[model samples]
Target: MLPLLVLVTLASIAALYVRGDLNPILCDGPCGPQYVTPPEGLATQSPDPDEAAAVGSGPIDGRELAAAVAGPLRSEALGGRTSLVAVDARDGKVLVDEGDGAQIPASTTKLLTAVAVLDAWGPDARFTTSVVRDGGRLVLVGGGDPYLTDAKSKGSSVERADLATLAAATAKKAGRGPVTLGYDVSLFEGPEVSPAWEDGYVGSVVAPVSPLWIDRGRVGAGRSTDPAADAARRFAELLRARGVEVTGEPTETRASGATIATVRSAPLSRIVEQFLADSDNEVAEVLLRQAALKAGQPGSFAGGAKVVSQVLSEAGVDTAGLVINDGSGLSRKNRISARTLAEAMAEVSSTPRLGSILSGLPVGGFSGTLENRYVRSGQARGLVRAKTGTLTGVHALSGLVTLSGGRPVAFALMSDDTKDVNPFVTQAALDRVVAAMADCACGA
Candidate 1:
């Protein structure tokens, strides 16, 4: 062995090298190490085609894909007629098409409503709910803001226009004494409940469509009988709590005087996202009417339907043979083809104004309406994002899905005649079909 001191010095040098603090080859003072730089040509080497192919692999056989998904779609569990259409979101190539013609769309109709509203009012548009002075009475004017709330306004994204905020603003101008309180729902005209809708839809799936309502006219998940009246009562209560005494019960009237306090809603884009993600019927209906108002038509179910069709047609979507009875698709008479839904989704992907609609769709096995769905199949768990529609006999799923090659595909599947079959079974069948699309490497 060498001297102990030499050995210790050698050990220290080795330790320094190990710790990356010493360079053996450079002994000069403050030595700068030289690194071998890769050549420009090597740095920019073209990716191997084979490796690219492997990374972007997808289904190569369309026949095999059809065979894989056909059985579940044809299963008796899905009652009545079944219509489906899938297209490459990038190229609009038809991946799957079955049973043409219109079918009951259910809540998937909101997708159309969303596009129409976004077309009529750009994403940045905002709705305003205001309090104006009508003589000595304070009249709350509805601006067709669906997301308005009773809770204190948090910010732009959370709470739009809260009663507390509106009341506080109104209190400052109206002085302390008792004032007559009323609300103007004239912003929306026609029947509160759609004649085409089933009676059970009220107080269950949706409330009466109104220009102004708190929490989407919901006491919770359940709906209030007369949402506008309920909202007016709540507004009065808030005004009373704010030291502004209300003389009597609040009633509906038109505001034809100076404006006092105004509160704007969250931007239209955010409302569309929440409506689509949560499948909010009230929001959908309100947006439908709002779209009609924007289009210079009466804010009614018929007016909204006409405006929606007109707007979609203007957007280059084929509205031929399309019948929209209501904005929310609560009406069983509502008919839409899978091709139309897929086309609309494709339009959403291509159109800059409507692009945000895709992000609002529920991701399979992850968020929103589809959280509990796609649980049985891992294939579509994170890859598929869709809107689910369910009624008694109607089961529909439509949205976008990323394939094996990371290509996005838009699909719409509807089964409207399965009243006899179990709903869970129908949903499972639909899930399997969408999951198959995600797993497919067709034409890879």
Candidate 2:
């Protein structure tokens, strides 16, 4: 009687499966009750707590932003002739504008150089430093890699084009003993030094421009007089270290034939970051010449300046009244308006190709050129990132900063023409102005 009862229950379960009236249970180890999926078009549930916290509030109020910056702009330390312009990066609306006319840009001119170079070559593009074998000679060709280093790596920084590595590889290909070493720097044309630059600038504020150099031609704090020759000499030393005997002096000439080994520069993006963050004058100059070459113009100061103006003008930024003497902005003759600088910042913020420029800016009270700035209490601190420029009475600060309401704004403040004022004072004034903008709650 018991066996018949069990059989009857099993037969009923089999009948339900055969009739397609049974719910399926899915399990890896043991079977569990089946789950009923919710019907389509069900009301959506809220996001988890972590995701909700990641969202930003909204745009800042322009009115409040203007109010925040007003007092700082009135500082007497900012010089008699001051030009300033701040715009909402989202819509290009002017938040603050004061004074007029062009002012000396100082190193902030590197911003213009950065844009022109990026326009000519995308961020991922890299400059090549190649060693080519022509006849009995080993030739090192410079592709204008300014940050090329001899060290394998500097701490955790990106690996640069290393001369020792290149030499070691080249020696393996070329038989040991009796090799003539030469370098080709003809990729760049015209004078190495910009004639428009101040006489004292060379070997002080900047080294003479050359495509082939190690450590920006610096022994330590001082610069070399002839960087190309010095670089070739260093290459010879590196070759000797690799058990290769070099015969004859290293001369400058173009290399033709098979490439032995090549090391590429840390991508253009990293170069831009280092140059802008450190305000590296020589790097800026080298990049300018490279930009000219890429644009199909002569790789000279004059040609670079011309192409930079053309590139910016074509991009719809007003280049009128803007004079670019040199890429590093060491020239006092280099003139730019606050409006133009602000527009350039806005362009970088909006254009995908130019976006990397913003990341290279020095963070306030944190890193690079701005490490010592914005240190005072109630200041912007890490809230601002900009390029600082200073020359005598001329001081300029320009870059992007987000307001309290999470809106990013681009600002440029140029103070010039004042006599006998301390540079630190002017810099402090400029920082205060930027801090005001960062501290704003504006149109929340």
Candidate 3:
């Protein structure tokens, strides 16, 4: 018995010697060792994809990439007004900078619009454009109709909440076979773009945002009617063609106290995701209105812009010189610095549900407005992920990208004018800067 006890003591000592050391878990705030108890049915679950990829991986070497980019991305090539800034989102470190302090976020300003909407309206909150019966007249109240169509191609198309569904629901809900449908566009103004917006830029590729339409009156050349109303009428005609009796002509009005039916929106997150992914001006405007409405404010651009500004200030983003003329960055007067954009990007990156606001951006050679713009070098091909902005003389890109060092980085580049320089040339230079960050390991 004594011998066995002695042997046990020796084994215990050997086991203690075998235990080596543990690395410290970095934390800026109060943190304790987490004791994770396996939940039922999750014992075999794998780690999250991002976490797993990061485990035990060393930082990537990006010196070559940075040097390569810095080589051709000449300051002289870009208009003097051009500015660029890149940051590592994972560590909040600046990866690259060229006049990052200068404020001029063109369409990239929509990112702020997206963040405001998401904060005001949680990810799953949806927009609703309603069709209701008021006494004998059918009242279609516009709840700032972001998605009010049968065109599945558009960001705001509502298949289940469209005219047919409204008609069907109206028929079933009222116990009456049919009702006179009255349209109300009073929910939003004719367009989200202010009357003060530059006249020459109107009716261009990206037009003003109006609540009651789709395509901003660019459905065809020189078109300027309400796209939503047109769609609703077409839908009504379709219903008539399908044997649903129509009694009154569709008329446009504002939202009223009478509401009979509503086409609800998908949650705010999904809608924001779609809008940010494509920089959909109409979606941005509608979302801004929806945010204002949700926040108990008037659903107008001014009200929404105020709320948006408040949201930014609350998020610790500096909004000193920021001017948001419209939800989309189509306005020339809209100004935001690269630093502000980078700051907003960083904050949103830290938020839980924003999901690859970085990943959603247009990669140099891959997607969105940049798809055809930057396809030259292999480094620039897939390394950059950013939002692209363009007006007569303005071009910009802002968002986040993963550096070769495996650090997620936030970046913004703005070009006011090329001075007779081709826009493509400026875009290529921006792509090179992004590629440099992707290739360099900045110890982030």
Question: What TM-score does each of the candidates earn?
Answer: 0.84, 0.84, 0.76
* Candidates sorted by TM-score, best first: 1, 2, 3
Stronger candidate by TM-score (1 vs 3): 1
lDDT of 3 by residue, 1-444 (tens): 999999998888655433311111222211222433332322212334565465434443234334645665665556767676665576565555555444555678788878877788777666676666665566656555565555433223222245556555555454446656566666655344565467655555444455555433456665443565675576577556556566777776544455656666555555565566677766777777777767777777777778888888898876767777667766666778787787788888888766535445666665677677546553645556678777666777787666543456677778786757777677667666666665554442
lDDT of 2 by residue, 1-444 (tens): 999999999999877654434532322111221432321211011223453344344555666777887888888888788887888888777777774878899988999999999989988889898999877898999889888877676432334678998888888988755878889999888998888888887787788899988888787778887888888888989998888888888998789879999988877876787789889898999999989999999999988998899888887776658999889999999999988888889888999888668878887766688877875545776667788888877889889876654567888889886557787777778887887886676662
Residue range 181-280, candidate 1, lDDT tens digits: 8889998899989989997889998999999888889987699988888888988888888888788899888888899999988778878887898898
Estimate the overall C-alpha local distance difference test score of candidate 1: 0.80
Q: What are the lDDT scores of the predictions, listed in order?
A: 0.80, 0.80, 0.62
TM-score-better candidate, 2 vs 3: 2
Quick one: how many clashes does candidate 1 have? 8
Worst 10 residues of 3 by lDDT: 21-30
Candidate 1: worst-modelled 10 consecutive residues by lDDT = 36-45
The parts of candidate 1 lying over 4 Å away from their true place are: 1-52, 55-68, 153-158
